[model samples]
Target: MTKTAIVTGGGRGIGQAIVERLLQDGMNVVTCGRGAEPADLPEGAVWVQADVVTKDGIDAIMKAAGRVDVLVNNAGVQVEKSVADSTDADYDLVMDVNCRGVFNMCRAVLPQMSETGGSTVNIGSISGMVSDPSMALYNASKAFVHGLTRSIAVDHGPKVRCNAIRPGWIMTAMAEDGFALANDPKAAMADALARHPVGRFGEPGDIAKIVSWLASDEAPYVTGECITVDGGMTAASPLNPGLF
Candidate 1:
């Protein structure tokens, strides 16, 4: 029988790539987001309009997709502000979508997944492992994701496997916009590219391929791991290009 997979925030970016990749892998994919399903979503995938931050939304997704064999928690938000400039509202919004949402989805799906073995792939970020300026809350939220992923692996192991993917500087719409907003878009982009030994930013497909592997039978022994898919951005220091 074909496995069933659910991908949150599948309307665009890495989530959409993951949905498409899973469909290519022959799994029945169910995608959810706060808005209507995008026209570009893969033809074979099912679209559920829901928000990950709310229990009602998560329930709606679970109700639409019964008995999930794989769950990809790709829904998240980012706020660019230092702690002094950040507001309580900013903290709440980021945490609600990034941390609480993951918790809610995992909680709702684990019981059903425990019945039969399954996997969960969370889309964390390199920001969780290292600090970045003007993104304090976003960093903290993803750190929570990494910690939660490990905890879930420990708690639900031998039945349900859990892991996280830490991507760096993916060329998504949000990332492009962030680049465009920089004082010198071209210079900023070039500097960012120089940090990665691969000489380019990551593509969504890079993350999708890893997610596919982690959820497959081939990765049965893999759990509680935070795999980095950053094109070597975090592997070395940006200041010491000669060291690499």
Candidate 2:
């Protein structure tokens, strides 16, 4: 079947990569972001400017797309601050965008998808599984995503299949900034590259490929699972450090 997919936060980075991949795979794609759509978006996909954090915005996205077979909840934010330094508003913003945004989109799309049983891929983060020093808000929000994925898979099974993709250091702007934080962006990237047992950080395409597979018939038997794509960062231990 030539399926249609709705990708949230699809203007750039990982979401943009997912949108392109789905289109390349011959799926009709509807991509949305908080900012304006890109100028030269792929042919098979349409763009919308909508906030995933709001009910009305989500409703508008689904209404335009219609009967989505795949929903990739790839919208999220990063807040790099100590818990003590962060404010309640900052926490709420992160929760609203990262956690609540996914919820709104999923809840809105589920009814239509339930009729034919669709697939959902939530874009989670390694920060949730492994605590980072200065990213408490983002970490908690992603942890919520993982838990929500499991719950959805269990509750909506025999119809809808839900899963999460926890990405490591992918070469998106997010990673670029982390690199820039050091004296040399190139050196920081090199450091991460050395850390991955595979000897490289991931491309957005890496996560996109995994999510695409999960949303297709190939992954019919899979549900309620979090597949980590962190180059085994979480798997490495004190005694068994990965590549670095």
Candidate 3:
């Protein structure tokens, strides 16, 4: 029997990569995003147009994908604001999509998953582990995801496996916008690269490959872990240029 997988926010970026990789693995892939399907979405995967921020949206996903063998909670939003400048609306938007969205998806899918044994891979961030300037709400929301990942693994283990992947700085559309906002995009890119020991930013396929492996039977014993897929960014010391 072919397994089924659902990846949220899969129209582009890391989500799209995960969807494509899963399709290559021969799993039945279903992807969803808030808006219309992008032209770049992989051909074989099914596209379900829905947002992860609301119960109805997740329910729509469950209705379209029955008996999900794998669930990838990849939908997220980032609000670049300081703790003092952040507003309730900012918190609401970030938390609704990043934290509550994952919770709702797991709540909806775990029962069926428990019956047959499945994997839940949440796309977390390095922000959850470390703080950055003007990213208070975004950092906090990802922390919620990390903590929730552990709790779910503890609560539903031996049947449903739950884990998270913390991607460092993938070259996604969001990261490009961040780079373009800088005063000197070239210099900014160089500075970002220097921070990682690999001397390069991650590609979406870097994350997609790990997600595919985690969802496979080969990783049956792995659960409740937040794997960091950064190019040694977190491992390198900011003050030690020689470390790299």
- Tell me how many clashing residue pairs each candidate has: 0, 0, 0
137-217 per-residue lDDT for model 1 (tens digits): 989999999999999999998899999999999999867766776789998888888888888798999999999999999
Q: For model 1, what is the alpha-carbon lDDT of residue 162? A: 99
Cα lDDT of model 2 overall? 0.86
What is the lDDT of every predicted structure here?
Answer: 0.91, 0.86, 0.90
Ranking by lDDT: 1, 3, 2
Pull out the clashing pairs in model 3.
none
Candidate 2 collision pairs = none
The better candidate by TM-score, 2 or 3, is 3
Instruction: Tell me the alpha-carbon RMSD of every candidate.
Output: 1.6, 2.1, 1.6
Query: Which clashing pairs does model 1 show?
Result: none
The CA lDDT at 190 in model 1 is 82
